[model samples]
Target: MSKQQMIPFQTTLFVKDTCLCLHAQRAARALARLFDEALKPHGLTNGQFSLMMSLNRPVPAGMADVAHLLAMDRTTLTAALKPLERRGLVIVAADEKDKRRKVLRLTPAGEVLLAAALPAWRETHATLDQRLPDIERLRADLRALS
Candidate 1:
């Protein structure tokens, strides 16, 4: 493209400064990094922590329910569960009542890990909440957007 026909560099600056999607993505990445670091000692990523947490319930959760709650597709959720399943931290099995459906539950080992990881997660969130001007509103806005 000729120099005269090229998009202006100022347009790039405008997007960097004002794009909501860009800002949200950057913030999400930053938050993920922080949680990843906090959960690192437990051999968990933020995504894994979230996935496991979604299965914490009185009954084994259906794969579809867990997938929806985690904002992931069933394929993605299934892939994410493999390492945890291999480690015996989680169990994925066919529902006895519905042979075609899969359900997920945390094993005793998973519960123990989650219990241990809770304090670290709590502490990190507390420190982060103190820094944010309005965490509740930010969360609500994010939920609405999602």
Candidate 2:
């Protein structure tokens, strides 16, 4: 048989667009870019801002706890934190209760940076909210999906 005759093809027109994932991905990328641009003056990426915010709790927390809270793997969290640690924005030390586990805490400098980044973050957040007034509904929908 010829190649065209040998091959079989199925045709269907009911493939509905499940573009929710794509839309979410694009929105995430765009938001990240906006945050990155706003945070540039403070030398922080959106991820770093998130990490710092996560660490801002009253008590120091174990790396495992942070990983769980951030929905990030330990290795990935460690890699992301390295720059902050190196820059004196964060401190990683052995957990007081469990010597084998590491605890993460924000340093004074980290607090300072977070404070500086807050205004920029708020600005970007407000701008996005104003531009996309449906964000609250979208956030609710996203949370429902999660």
Please tell me which predicted candidate would have the highest lDDT against the true structure: 1
Worst 10 contiguous positions by lDDT, candidate 1: 1-10
Candidate 2: which pairs clash?
none
Model 1: per-residue Cα lDDT over 68-119, one tens digit each: 8988999999999999999999999999999999999999999999999989
Residue pairs with backbone overlap in model 1: none
1-146 per-residue lDDT for model 2 (tens digits): 66555332332222223566666888789888989989999999999999999999999988988898778999999999999999999999998888998999999999999999999999888887898869899789978876
Candidate 2, number of clashes: 0
TM-score of each model, in listed order: 0.95, 0.85
Query: Model 2: what TM-score?
Result: 0.85
